[model samples]
Target: MDPVYHIPALLNETIQGLAIKPDGVYVDVTFGGGGHSRAILTQMSAAGRNGSGKLYSFDQDADSLRNKIDDNRWHFVHSNFRYLSQWMDYYGEQQIDGLLADLGVSFHHFDEAERGFSFRFDGPLDMRMNQQAGRTAAEIVNTYDEEALARVLYIYGELKNSRAIARKLISARQQRPIDTTGRLAELLSGQKKELTCVFQALRIEVNDELGALREMLVTARDLLRPGGRIAILTYHSLEDRIVKNFLRAGNIEGTIEKDFYGNILTPFRLIEKGLSAGEEEVNRNPRARSAKLRVAEKIG
Candidate 1:
């Protein structure tokens, strides 16, 4: 595994939270650097249940293919995690023992300038996680109407000055297309946080991150066997809130349903509630500071 590709956050905590069953099936939906996936594979025993335990790692980014595992029990699916159910069905897996998703951008993408995931470097404004499909960040910046652009920034980035930023982008593109990361970054000059928000908003828009996340969460809820766990590491509040709500209520809307006894009905029993990394880990890898791991086990 490439250590530089990504340093899995809360690695020990997440693996322990899953409570791996040696003869049970597992899935790693975000196999960025194969760190977590490799860890999961280590816990499974090949001799158990006639060597039936398996792991299916999903990654939409073709770049991740380079880090594929060579283990016979490992299967790499080159597709978005939103298609989790379909792919699981294709593999004849009706129920999974555990599922994991580490939802942060890999260091490789941010460090590589041409990928356009970060504003620290100059490159084309292309932020598609799956480079083969979807509109580039530049296309959204240049083509989205002011209101649409502002909505993306406000909803995804949580930027208070989304309207102003959108207006400025609209005005700037009128002179010439906003095509490169440097040019876009120059136009968005402001407090570092705001600049990060703008770039984050564009990347989320380009990849439909939230929408895909919701779909995958729902599918995972349905596909997990009773007592099976799902562990997710979220980097931002937007995705974190969605995950927290779904795990608590067993639905994306987070509505709690109570029985005649006033007991709440939920498919999952919460295991970890937005647990963050320790200061020691954060000091070692600053990028882990924002990661929150939420784990839940399906109620039998």
Candidate 2:
């Protein structure tokens, strides 16, 4: 694939936020399009004159591996970042010096109509991040109970009209199964404002994205050595909230109660308050508008 797709412009800032050390091992948990991975490699290689540093890249999409560049120092793992810890153990590695994650979906998934990740395309309701994963968007939309569907939209997608949309879907699927992405889109045409939310809910349920992200973060907390930095770029508020809470309180609950001595306890210390793309970057890449970058270093 050509490099026409634009990734987050804060790649260099994210790598530098890691405080990259020569000969240090790094991990790019989401190797989408390899933009961030390529930048990290360039900096790490320049730092280490002998080029002995290593980079471990992980992606659940098998198609991403096809675009892997021929590099001796980098190892690509064809699995979800949720299993970062397992892969680290398999590679006989204890911890990494830095970890970078660009949590946004790759352009390929959205640009490809058949993937059913975009609302612009009329295609099958198939939004599986990993092809091998069970349950497609069609299955959830066609089979889930009205109440469950409403919950999915309300929580994951934060749709205000979730109940109405879920009821409409259930009624529509009763007459005819919601098979294609366009079919569902047509059925919910009355609720056009909630179209993105409905689809986002279906995609989240089909792929269990939130659950996977939580697992990956927990595993990362364990895999990163002390002072090791973890940078996460989240596109949606749901993901950003999780990242923020986790980094600030060392847990997703975001509770920061003080101890008897009035001292707070946290596992991760904030590096920069937040990292965001500049106005110039947003102008060049509109997709960067929704991105929220957060960086933290492992402390406890």
Error of 1 at 175 (Å): 0.9
Clashes of each: 0, 0
Cα lDDT tens digits, model 2, 1-300, are 564543655776787788887678899988878888888888877754448788999988887886696777789999888888889999988988889888857888888778888777888889887888788898888888989988998998898878988898888888989888778778877355578777777777887888888998888888888989998888888888888988888776778968899988887889866677889888988888777788999985
After superposing candidate 1 on the true structure, give the runs of residues whose Cα lies further than 4 Å from its correct spot: 1-3, 46-50
- Deviation from native of the Cα of residue 233 in model 1, angstroms: 0.5
Clashing pairs in 2: none
Residue range 179-256, candidate 1, lDDT tens digits: 999999888775688889998888888999999999999999999999999999999999999999999999999999
TM-score of each: 0.97, 0.94
Alpha-carbon deviation at 212 in model 2, angstroms: 1.1
Per-model CA lDDT versus the true structure:
0.92, 0.83
lDDT of 1: 0.92
